[model samples]
Target: MKALVIGGGIAGLLAARVLTETCDDVVVLERDKLSDVPEPRAGVPQGRHVHGLLVRGGEIMEGLFPGLYDELVQAGAHLMDAGEMRILNPLGWVASTRTGLPLLVVSRPLLETHLRRRLTAKIVDDVHVTGLSFRGSTVDGVLTRNGRVDADLVVDASGRSSKLPSWLAEAGITVPEPDVVDSRTGYATRLYTAPPDFPVVIAESLSAPDTPRGGIVMRIEGDRLMVTAQGAGGDHPSREPEGFQEFLDSLRGPIAEMLTDAEPLTPVYLFARTASRRLAFEQTPGWPGGLVAVGDAVCVFNPVYGQGMTVAAMGALLFRRHQDFSAKGCRDFQRKVAKIAQGAWALSSNADQSWASEHHAPGPLKRAFGWYMKKWQVALTHDQDMFARFVRVVHLVDSPAALMNPVVFRRLAKYSRQDPRRGRRRAGSNPR
Candidate 1:
């Protein structure tokens, strides 16, 4: 089989990597001329910001590219123990406890380049994929600036800026309508280099009643730190240095003090394309054969939650598992990938809706669910086991349905009664 993958981002590379297992010849078409070295690209503005591969996604990627994790570590990526990683919810501090999973902390561009290097297929960079070439009902190949190269299959792994729908329309296919959930959130990121032994702190605020400030500071490749400040709704972070420090000060505690003393390596890089969007390609009628979409082309989540890369890896894994490459294979692959994207879309948008307030009041279920989630967070603080269980859900290792487990609920209730004051503190406190 001959396969042509559009986009050379993490998702595009992942698709090519997996498809190579079945296709005899595979080629990746990338718009930007990616450097042999790991560096940011003009097309991926978000790559300038902080990013981390979640435990589940990290594991999947590691399996896909053996020894790549070690390469990243040697390249200066921090391997944080999942259990030891600190997280602050609306409730108080979530203690660092090991869950036996490790998170890969590296710059997004570095991660993408490192993953791409593992693929054996040819990557044609500096070429824009204008659209898909087709005949009758089959996708024959992709139209590029150079020309068209015929292929048996085409995979759209383009990120959030994908124009697959328009390409499909041009090819006589009716793309499905998309479901959008806009949060109007905004964030600013900057790089800092601290002393070799400076304290490593990762803090954030969960969107909740009363307070709204949140930030994350973690060690990335080299002696550098990636600090990102975020706000719910239209609350945008400052672009100036002084205003940036003030934003950190607005957080709970210690986070501000540490950031105040740390050294800044780069100016505050601001971006505001924060929204939860999911494409309903699986629902589209008369879908054409020999073509499929993956990655942000399929779903885009609020980066605040760090779901995009992880969900993209999961989508690629789904394709790998199914080993689908034909017309029927395209349909089945899209359906499965959509299911995976739905879980993440629901998790992020549901959380974002909670802070809508009068600006964007949610429907009945979302409002009700948010209320319960607040209590559940409090439960996590009082019960270490509950926190562990909940962390699995948060990391996408387990489903949200796991929260409904009877035993877990009972334990939370018992812990709350045993220490009401502590429970309240845990419930009300936000982690950095």
Candidate 2:
């Protein structure tokens, strides 16, 4: 089988590598001239900002490419035990417990470059996928600017801005209207050199009934730090140096002071128009055959949660299991992945909805669940088990249902009132 993967981002490249094992030949089509080294491209706008491969994401990447974790660490990616780091939940400080899995922190470019080198396939750059080359209901290949390339399957791993829906429509497939949850958020990121002892510090001012400002700082490759601050709605952060610092200070805690002392590396990179979008591809009854959509092309979540790469990896794994380059296989694959995407989409967007002035009232179930989850967040500040469970869901190692399981809830109920004063004292000692 020949596989033609559209978009050369992480999802496309990873899918190509996996498909190459089962297919006769694999080709990746990328619109932008992807950088061979660790650098930003026009396609991945979020590459200019901070990104972290959660513990679950790292594990999946390793499964795809053996020894990939060490390869990334040696390339300047920082691997930190989630337990050693301090985390502040909406309620308070999340208690530290050793989560055996470690998160990999690096610029998106470094990770992509490493993956590209390992895959050993020449990424066909500068070619834009214009449409599908199909025969009746079967997709034969993709029509690109360079011309047509024949294939048995065409996987649209294109990022969020994918034109596949339009292409499919032009090819005569009517897609269902996408489910869009706009957060109307903006992000500004800058690089800094921090104290060697305290490399990465994450401080968040979570969205509440009143405040909706948040920020994250992580130790990336090159011993540098990447800090990003986000404001809800049109609460945009200024691009000026002084104003940027002020924005950081306006965040909940010590991030402002820590950033003030760190050595500045790059200018502030600003990104706006962030919205959680989910395309209901599974609901399209007339969906075409031999064509599949993966990655952000299917669902784009708020990057603040850092779920994109991990979710994409999981989606690729799903494709391998459910899709066999057939039209019906494509439809089944979309439906299965859509179920996974909806869970993550709800998790992130529902959180975004909490920004009071933003005005997103979730349904009764979401509202009630959100209320309990907030209590769980408070429980996480004091209970190690709760923190572990919360992180498990955040990293997608476990399903959201796991957090709501009777086991976790029963534990939370048992421990919430056991020892508040003692918990605060112990948590206070461990400064991030």
Candidate 3:
């Protein structure tokens, strides 16, 4: 069978890798002329910002590309223990201890470079896909700028700007309106030369309603350090160097202090189009055969939570479980993709709802969840075990329900009532 995959980003690359298991001819069409080097592409502007694959995302990727982890580390990527990483929550610093789960800390460019090199599919760059091609109600292939390229299966992983909805509309089909939760998030990122003692991964928590500013500093491949400063509710981190440093100084923790010794290698780059949106394509009445949507084409998440890549990885993993390529098969997979994205969507969208968002109303349930999580952040300040459970949940390694168990609930009930910012419950020693 011949499969046509759109886009050459991580989602498309992973989907193409998965398809290679069943299809002999798997072709990935990328719009931009991909650089042989591990540099950011024009299409993926967010590539310039800080990024990390959740543990599950890293596992999914490593599974698709055997020995990929070792290869990355050899090329200067870091394999850091999750417990060793530090987080500054609104309440205080989360206690650190060994948790066994390791973080694969690498930049988007480095990760993409490795994945593309290891991918077994044919990657054709500079090919712009215009629309879908069909034969008697069945999807035959995708129509590109050059001409129609025929295929038995088509996967859309074209990212946030995907035109699948309009393409379907041209076929007399319609898709449901996307569920949106926009917090008006923006990011300002820069590369730097880390000091020898700089922490591998460190972040200041940025949730809505209280702390609208957050940032992370990560050491990636080539011994380089990447720092991303972010703000929600239109309080964007400034692109100018002076303003960027000012924004960093406004954070609650040591983000600014930690960077004092680091030398910047690049000017601050700004990215502003971050919103949590999920297109209900699975719920569409009539989905054609030989078609599937993955990654940002299906759902997009706030980068602040680091769920987009993981959710997309999870969606790619679904392809291996289903093999029916019929119209019903495609529809079934799409439905499953919706279910897969649900948890991450809940997290990002609900978190955004906690902000004063016009796109989503924080009904009682969302507001309550947000409140509990915020208080739980306070609780994490004093309890390492609780923080570990919360970390696993954030990494998609464990269920969110884990944080709501009786033990955690009982503890939070006792400790989370006081906000540390008020100087009331700040008894514990917060170690960096």
Candidate 1, superposed: residue stretches over 4 Å from native: 199-201, 323-326, 356-364, 415-432
Lowest-scoring 10 consecutive residues by lDDT in candidate 2? 421-430
Q: Which prediction has the highest lDDT against the true structure?
A: 3
TM-score of 3: 0.96
TM-score of each: 0.93, 0.93, 0.96
Clashes of each: 9, 2, 0
For candidate 2, the per-residue lDDT at 32 reads 90
The residue-by-residue lDDT of candidate 2 on 125-226, one tens digit each, is 899888898888898988877788888888899988899889878977888888676666788999888765764556564655555677778888788888
Count clashing pairs, candidate 3.
0
The weakest ten consecutive residues by lDDT in model 1 span 423-432
Deviation (Å) of 10 in candidate 3: 0.6
Model 3 stretches astray by more than 4 angstroms: 359-361, 417-431
Q: How far is candidate 2 from the true structure (C-alpha RMSD, Å)?
A: 2.6
RMSD of each: 2.6, 2.6, 2.0
lDDT of 1 at 2: 91
On lDDT, who's better, 1 or 2?
A: 2
